[model samples]
Target: MDRVLLSIGHGYSARALARLLKPQGWRIIGTTRSAEKAGTLAAEGVEPLIWPGTEIGPALAQATHLLTSVSPDPEGDPVLRQAGTAIAAAAPRLSWAGYLSTTGVYGDHRGGWVDETTPLTPSTERGRRRVAAEEAWAAVPGLPLHVFRLAGIYGPGRSAFDRLRAGTARRIVKEGQVFSRIHVEDIAQVLAAAMARPDPGGVYNLADDDPAPPQDVIACAAELLGVPVPPEIPFETAELSPMAASFYSESKRVRNDRIKEALGVRLLYPDYRAGLAAILAAERAG
Candidate 1:
């Protein structure tokens, strides 16, 4: 049996990946910070284990593949900080290892396009941390580490529809600003494809074909729900949370050609339109 260990699997993208691989005869063991999340993973047919609780002895030795979706904190990459040596020691048994990163590592491109080879010039603290984390993982000796730089991820309960219904959706318009996004399903599919074709120390950008403005996506969701689209708020005057405002600082259209060419990935939802429509359709069916 193919055994994979997902560090920080309770997150949105990792959970989706677990579902995608479970049916393929893969035994998945996911780590979480809490027993609450462990129970959730268990209910979804995944073996959940608490991370940083015990030495990752059995899991690390048994895993053929390992993936870490945990983000870097001020202290640095959490997983690497905790188990870097153990992970390196177990590299002989591990066929592939993956680290989930963000496109923010490219920093503010002033609405230009960026690819995998783009220089890391992050403008935000979070982006800087991600860059540092990516480097740390790459330096792990003998670990077949592949880095996936993900764009804005949205799916199911996390889409604009939920925000609109919750009365928290905003049409914050920053002039000449567009952002690349990826459906969660696409991220899961791409990871699966990468697992099939392991590439050590390869970096791939996971983004959709369409890079749209924030306001336009909100308008589209409103149209789907027959709700009034919120009035456009100028980005300069909009009262955005620190985290939300930080997103506006960067504007880059991320290219996903590598995923397509290398992984042979045909996206299930190529753009926001297709992605949002699928979310709405699923809601209606439920």
Candidate 2:
């Protein structure tokens, strides 16, 4: 293993992975569409390439592992649209390739449990686009593809605590509305495990053991912070952004057995309670 990871759309989850891998001798090279983010990655010891603008010749040639976390728009996957030829050229040398997808692909499971084998019946256009993107990567000849359907991602700087502190926390009660989530650290572990045990053409669901109600998570965060949980508003009455409202339309508890059984991953924060507590502790330490 050369220990070189080329991360496409190096954002939150990818950054966490970089932090874990760096201390263990992995060289992280990543792409960002913005100049500011490129500078940020450079400061973190990642060799940042400006995608859609910069040529991916050197990084693609050198990367032993590849991870793409970019979401597809209506047009299609920006990465494949931008660098298909270059990626194809580097395919034979790449050891493992991962596409970060969403669990929303199993749309509105009515709070029922869903696994990797569940047929994708996405209700949102976003989920439909993701399904399209997954197929796009799979069709790329000889690319060692692994699709990870990630549940809601919450972490250090992006948790319910931030919302609570900023006075944006709301308890929107929708009966039977439950969501599965994974900590960014857990996501990093899953990706690392997959890299260690490469399974070409594999798909895994990334989620914590607990599938819980949305309002309960907010209440838990408030409790941890010793703040009053905001007044609960019925889902129909609560004013929400279209994006936020879209989330309420689906309900599913995603199973993560494959990641544990295949990749040997034990989640560091197995539930929102543990995840939120760790985030608060980290903030206090700093």
Candidate 3:
């Protein structure tokens, strides 16, 4: 079988995965709605297709692997709604499939730890939608699906450094609250490893070992930048949109032991400190 990945709803995470697969001579077909992003993906050596606007059946026909990072809404999963039937038909032909899910599906754990076996009891509608989406994707027979529950993704342009430099980084003090995070590269590598060692129906939580308070991460970013650390703003007092506040509502440490054990993977940036430092060094290098 040819190594071809049909990536639906290709975004930041999928782009990182492509960076790894493209070097290995894998043909990547990533979908995007924007013409500009399509051009960018093409520049990165990925064959981009305008999706939801174009038929994905042709691409699905040729794919040996499938990956989707699309989020569901009040209605349902877009990939399933648009190409679910096509994906179902392509399942038997696919060697591997991956669904990019959020750890939010595990819901709040009161700063406690959660593993892949944890039950899905999301407090918010967003989390509920993820649980629903996961089930929907798994329902496809012979899909050889692997679900990855990702932590807060940080790297390059999307790290705390950008917020600090832009004077928007906040040290929100929510006592007894902490969250796990993973570097984008780490996530990319883990996904690649999973592909190399396909374990269908496997669900892995992708996160660094360290789960620290949100404020500490912000403080470290300021110190690294040699800027004044942003003052602590109590979570309640902090002015935030509903979406931002929702992040504060849930607090849990996500365990990534399965990825290390099952895939024999070691994290590149294990903690926020190392992750932030690399971002800073990359900036100074350029």
Candidate 4:
């Protein structure tokens, strides 16, 4: 049987990917920060390894496939700082390695379309950290390093509909502000497809077909829920957290042609409307 290792596996997308791959007879090994989450992971049929800046042991060196969703903070990534050496030591044995990054690395493209070949010029500290982390992982020898630049990820219980129901949905308008987004399930499928092909040293942009304004997405959600659309607020007048406002500063449409051509996969939710419909359906059924 084939085996896969997932670092920082206790995330929304990682858990979904584990479930998707489990039925295909792949032995899943996952790492978590907490012992309690490790126990939960074990119950979910994943071989849970506790890694919290401590020794990573031989598990880092033995996996056939590796995926990491760890984000870099001011203190930096513990797994990479400590266990990266172990992974680098084991790189020669690995088939494929994937690092999840963000489209924020492209910075504000001014609503222009960006593809895999676009030069990275991240504007924010978080995006800069991600770029740095990408460089760190790319430096590893003998590993098939693949970087996935993900857009706004939404799925299941985590959609705009939930916000609308809670009466907290906002339609903040910034002129020319648009963002590309992708459902979490599509992200999993893309990752799986890339793993199957094992593209070493390749970069792929993951996004949906439509790149719409933020207010449009919220209005669509309200329309789907049969509720009044939230009133749009000017960017200056809108109450937004520092992080949220930072996201609005960028206006880029990420292209998915490379993922389609290379991975041979199609997005389950091509846009927010379709994705919202599915989430609403699931909520109704439950």
lDDT scores of the candidates, listed in order: 0.91, 0.94, 0.94, 0.86
TM-score of each candidate?
Answer: 0.98, 0.98, 0.98, 0.95
Q: What does candidate 4's lDDT look like per residue over 1-286, in tens digits?
A: 5576655555778887888899998878888889888899999999888877445666675688888888987766655787777788878888888899999988889999999889999999998998888888888788789999999989987788878888888999999999999999998899889988987998999999999998999999999889999998999999899989999889999999999998898889998999999988888899
lDDT over C-alpha atoms for residue 255 of model 4: 96
Can you list the residue pairs that collide in candidate 1?
none
Error of 2 at 34 (Å): 2.1
lDDT by residue for model 3 over 1-286, one digit each (tens)?
Answer: 5699999888999999999898898999999999999999999999999987998899999999999999998998988987878899999999999999999998899999999999999998999999999999999988999999999999999988899889888899988999999999999999999999999999999999999998999999989999999999998899899999999999999999999999999999999999999988988999
What would the per-residue lDDT of candidate 1 be over residues 124-225, giving only the tens digit for each residue? Answer: 999999999999998888999999999999999999999999999989999999999999999999999999999998899999999999899999999999
- Model 2 sits at a Cα RMSD from the real structure of 0.9
Candidate with the larger lDDT of 1 and 4:
1
Q: What is the Cα-based TM-score of model 4?
A: 0.95
lDDT: the better of candidates 2 and 4: 2
Cα lDDT for residue 132, model 3?
A: 95
